[model samples]
Target: MGLNGFSFYNFPTAIELEYHQPLDKFEKEINEENILYGDKGRAYLKIFFDF
Candidate 1:
């Protein structure tokens, strides 16, 4: 699953937020553990300046 959002106003700046994760099952226990143990999901924030 994944999601994204952006905002733009009168200001000369823009903001973005995103999140993503695996939605499918793994074939092996090690694979599943490797994917789910540490960084199972990821998120990001970005800003843009327009001039």
Candidate 2:
């Protein structure tokens, strides 16, 4: 899942927001038990300027 939005009318520079979810799964076995790890989701922001 992912989402993205942008705004350019309220600020001097254009702004962008982004969200992402890979929804991935990982497992490991050490003693017959399942272990999950690693990153599950992430987000970021961006700004654009014209000079």
Candidate 3:
């Protein structure tokens, strides 16, 4: 495969979520551990791909 053979594919929208604080009890429980990146809320990432 060469660079010329490649073409521009669909640039799917990248949705970025920001956690300001725990919105509900479930978020609070999960964020209590501090194992995640957030202190007041849980941090996460979403990837769109199906295999």
TM-score of each: 0.46, 0.47, 0.26
Model 1 misplaced stretches (Cα beyond 4 Å): 1-11, 25-39
Summarize candidate 2's per-residue lDDT along 2-51 as a digit string, tens digits: 34455557565655667777667778897999887655766878777651
Q: Candidate 3 overall Cα lDDT vs. reference?
A: 0.40
Model 1: which residue pairs collide?
Answer: none
- Cα lDDT tens digits for candidate 1, 1-51: 334445457667766677776566554367456443333667888777773
**Model 2, which residues run further than 4 Å from truth?**
1-12, 27-39
Model 2 pairs whose backbones collide: none
Candidate 3 lDDT over 1-51, as tens digits, reads 111122236654343444446554432335455333333655555444321
In the order shown, the candidates' Cα RMSDs to the true structure are: 5.6, 5.1, 11.5
CA shift at 22, candidate 1, in angstroms? 1.2
Q: lDDT of all predictions, in order shown?
A: 0.60, 0.66, 0.40
Instruction: Give the 10-residue window scoring lowest on summed lDDT in candidate 1.
Output: 31-40
Find the number of clashing residue pairs for candidate 2: 0
